[model samples]
Target: MAIQLVTDQLSNVLDDTLRSQLVGNFKEIEKALNDLDGAQARLNSDQDKINQDLKNIKDGNEIRDVNVQAIVNILTKYDVPIQIVNGKVVDTTKEGE
Candidate 1:
């Protein structure tokens, strides 16, 4: 089946050359529009994947935070000799202090 276009219905009498050129221009525009539409679809799919990845990371972070807090609470409750030094948790238990 052929793509029916409005220019195809035009009477190609004395203005056949001009009408043919117009048809070529219209075909080029249609091709560009199709390419643009395809790019938009691909970008939308990529964005959806990125959003899902971000959501997974956020969920993992929440779980990690809960676990860290639970450990901190237990250590604090037991009065453990743990201290943060230079952003690291260190055990301060010594033979005599």
Candidate 2:
């Protein structure tokens, strides 16, 4: 017996079309999932860098103001609105008033 053959051949034809459509839909979903995974990996990498920098600061290790400035500049390049005040970076959008 054929994978699609049934008592009603017309319905089986429709079933084949539906199956193809479902396969196409799944392929698209798979691609989207892969893209999301890539984005999440990139985000994790960035978070790791931020964590290391923060750890350095928390350890009381000497860090130049210019090094902080460079980090601010990197964030700014991504169009992330942040303000540096007293050597701390604050999200400008979250500020009250």
Steric overlap count per candidate: 0, 0
lDDT of 2: 0.75
Which model scores highest in lDDT? 1
For each candidate, give its TM-score against the true structure.
Answer: 0.67, 0.45
Looking at candidate 2, the ten consecutive residues that score lowest on lDDT are 1-10
| Local accuracy of candidate 1 as per-residue lDDT tens digits, 1-97 | 2445555555667597767867876997798789889999999999999999999999999898677667766896899877555645677788678
Clash list (residue pairs), candidate 1: none
Give me the overall lDDT of model 1.
0.78
Candidate 1 regions exceeding 4 Å error are 1-14, 83-96
Q: What TM-score does model 2 achieve against the real structure?
A: 0.45
Query: lDDT tens string, model 2, 1-97?
Result: 1133222323345577667666766777777779889999999999999999999896654556667788889989998899698768888886574
